[model samples]
Target: MLDYRLFKQIDDCFASGHADKARRLLMEVQSRSIALRDEMNMLHIRLKTLEDALQLARNLFNRDGFYWLKTGDVTQGPFCPRCYEDEGALIRLERTGSKLHCPYCHASFIGSARAAGGGAHHAHILPFV
Candidate 1:
């Protein structure tokens, strides 16, 4: 978003034998260029963040009361539903006995019996706490 008029002003300064003014204008141009570069880098970072959010939205699903992330043929999580619903975060649940716990929100869920057996119902929940 640099103004092209600055370059013309620099050219006019040089034509009018205002060498000091031309040098100052050149420095201004350099400063503007650096600012533009930094702004572009920030925009790229924002774009990457938005893309990652889109991908997560496309892949995330709910089974029973818990959240799961699926990519390709692989399924990834038994995330905390309360955390995801309230904060848009994919906080992984920690299993203990027949219960799953969310460390972030201190929420607990009743995990499936098949969870201990490494079955497909791993971390699948029946109720919330």
Candidate 2:
């Protein structure tokens, strides 16, 4: 079976802006899971789910306090990145005129700081593969 601890670690890495590290860790877990004689199928499924979440993170357009999923050549959201990183949520903000609203936390904002992501401080994630 897939351990909840792995998911927690993945969440930690993502919350700290370590998508690459989370992906590496997921790969390592997947490799180790190959040796398990039972519960292998279920574990594989869970690993795949975790990987998908991180992949979503990678594709996110980091905005001021949220992230947008740029998919199909169109930007999909002004989602709360904090919610996504914390709980793997894709909480979409409701657009009202020039302001966007997050129902989860009830925050209001306009525009994006998407370009701000490039200069974010890197986390010191341990090497894993």
Candidate 3:
């Protein structure tokens, strides 16, 4: 916080021909300004991180023991539940045989089977709750 009294003291020092004292006071003001700027920047970063987490929480949904991210009309992911629940990470699960595998946490989940006509297997998409 900037103290108005410091400015008065600095002015008085300069008027009394105390150049060194005035210079030292100016340096103190500069240091305070820099520290204030750093604190503000850190607060901005924290606020942005919190906003991102809130957005993700708003879009994230769970179904059949799996997590999914739904955005607008486009839904993406069948993220690993264990990784998300334990570590707060949305690790996308890779399909392998009859399971979905997490490359990051090495966890697995049972996925839907392929269609009879060899079409792609589709998981049931649900709305975010």
TM per candidate comes to: 0.79, 0.48, 0.81
- Across residues 4-113, which tens digit of lDDT does each residue of candidate 3 receive? 79999999999999999999999999999999999999999999999999999999987656777888976777787777889998988888887777898776555563
Ranking under TM-score, best-scoring first? 3, 1, 2
Q: Using lDDT as the measure, what is the rank order of every candidate, best first?
A: 1, 3, 2
Best-performing candidate as measured by lDDT: 1
Candidate 3 residue 85 C-alpha distance from true site, Å: 0.8
Better of 1 and 2 by lDDT: 1
lDDT of 1 by residue, 9-117 (tens): 9999999999999999899899999999999999999999999999998999877667888889877767888889999999988887878888888777775523222
Task: Specify the highest-TM-score model's number.
Answer: 3
Clashing pairs in 2: none
Off by more than 4 A, model 3: 113-129
Candidate 1 residue pairs in backbone clash: none
Better of 1 and 3 by TM-score: 3
Model 3 root mean square deviation, Cα atoms = 6.8
